[model samples]
Target: MFLSKLALAVMVWTLAACSETSGWNNVIDSHEPKQGESTPSKDNSDTTLASEPVSVGGAFLVCAADDSFEMEAFGCRLEDVTGEKLNSTDIKDGDLVVSNGTQAYSAVAIEGSESFWHWYIAAPLADVSLYTVQYVGQIADILNVETEVQIQHPEKQVSEVTMESPYDDRHLMFVTSIAYQAGQVQNGFNSLASADALCNQHALANGLPTSFKVILSTSTVAAAERIRILYPVYNLEGNLISNPNQFWTNRHLAAVVADKMPSSSEEEEDVTLFEVWTGTSNSGLVKGTETCADWTDNTANEKGNFGMASDARKWVDDGGSRTCESRLRLYCLSQ
Candidate 1:
């Protein structure tokens, strides 16, 4: 049932052209030549089909380090990684490449005397251990042997890799966006299965991984026990919430932010109501019979347990029942 709903969601999103506008494109366009204008001539032959295969050399790690959240482009200084200087003659844009041991990527732009090679992953990968540049013929035939290059900074662990979305986080513990209400969606919402689909939809829309689940609890199940916890929860600002010795509770939430008060300029209206529907308690355990009728009936007069974004004490329970009819957000995490 979940698979069917997910497939339908994917079809709808694809038809809607859900691709997001990324900053990476700006970097790509910076070096692209104008129409009808020829690029600088080099000794390297055009990537055209020839009677014989071409031998492309100087294959070395280009993006040796993990990407940062602020990174608009994924690349490395060629000389810094390979210890060999190169020019456009060594490699050119539009080359087909592989990374992470067989994942395909494309060379989008090159710059700085071949100092850097900007790459675009058609399907963004979590981490790329190595990159292989391929030499092709005019008919797009492989012409020569491939050269593999390892990341220069192999010590850089996956956790250090920053991403544009939580779904892209290496640990896969990152949570994406929250739903605005607790209701059965026509395409599957409110229920745990629908919640997962919504998380995946957000990830797909942002060009990130879709393996996500909701941090929710039913009357009989606990959110913490069901979902695998890899790291402390992080807010949209990338700040850590759940940390060592600290759990996801009203007390912890208030303690973490007590020292760092929100700016006065921060408008309450601008903030998406953090009143997220979590049938679990401050200790990550399911509490009362407040799961919005087991997350199926949004109109049920009974309320569901929820957490407040601004009020730490209210994160788990507000000492009051919130009607199931009220529209609220959901907390989702990737497994």
Candidate 2:
């Protein structure tokens, strides 16, 4: 099903107004003037619901439920998982690395334990999940930030739905942001935490089993001046969902880019903030210091449903970022 760009924009804008706090770039490019959540940045409190989302048929959503993993299986972490609102990670170290087949594991467990639960391990493959990626310049992004780009990836395994945008004849997206600073790294940084929840919510809002994926940073006291990564093409998805076995801890087959960053002048646009696809949920920023990566991953498509008719190609041709959060469009698709 083809999505409506104008419609999507309107809906997103409306949702953002209600959220009162996220950076709705797909809809509204500016971050909230008030800082309602944690900062990696700053804030604004005056934004309100600009309008209401036009509901088709009726004003409510009737969703079809799925049989999936239950957090009770993971015990205390379950609540920690559910209660979380966002996932923000710091990329203390690298930029362009590819994923091996194995899950690109989080070295630091949330709340400080050794390893995450097996369920938590299901991140790259969980339903109703959140994932954020540090975005740089891949194809066409006018904004200027270094080392981090938060994102949302949604999927419905069995449902057929259509989202639309508002640009009448303009099928192309024009990303134009001022330059910013990404100070040369001294250590590694983790990816965004709240960015994870925002993405998962995107899928769920659309009535699909939710799963999230994004790129994050890990700091090493002496990792490198410029952080980079490469996940095996096979291990990586258009989103950052990578196969653990094939790409885990490995960098051979991964697709990557280096030295593709903002210069010191451009780095002045450096604002450690979020430019997101806003929705009707609470402000997109969950906790400044809290990240969802601490949650367990489930084996099943635990959030929504899906179908096979949607067009991802159009999403790109329509002006989506060349690499908003780590999608690789330059490589040849596996035949």
- Best-matching candidate per lDDT: 1
lDDT, candidate 2, 1-335, per-residue tens? 24688788889999879776554443565444343443232265434533222212211000111234242111011111112211223111232221223434332123333322111222333321232222221212211111111111012221333323222211111111222111111211123333333323433443423333322221211011111112112212223222211111111223221112232344433322212221101101122211112211112221111101012212112222111221111111110
TM-score of 1: 0.41
lDDT of each: 0.50, 0.22
Off by over 4 Å in 2: 1-191, 205-208, 218-243, 249-335
lDDT of 1 by residue, 1-335 (tens): 99999999999888666443344556655786655445554674444322333333422333333354244324432322222333334344555454555556655544445333434333343322234444332222221224333222222332544334444332233232333456767633667888878666765665556766777888766675556544445554556554311343343333111112122233422345556677876546565778887787777577887776566556655556578877665555655
lDDT score of residue 281 within candidate 2: 13
TM-score of model 2 (CA atoms): 0.16
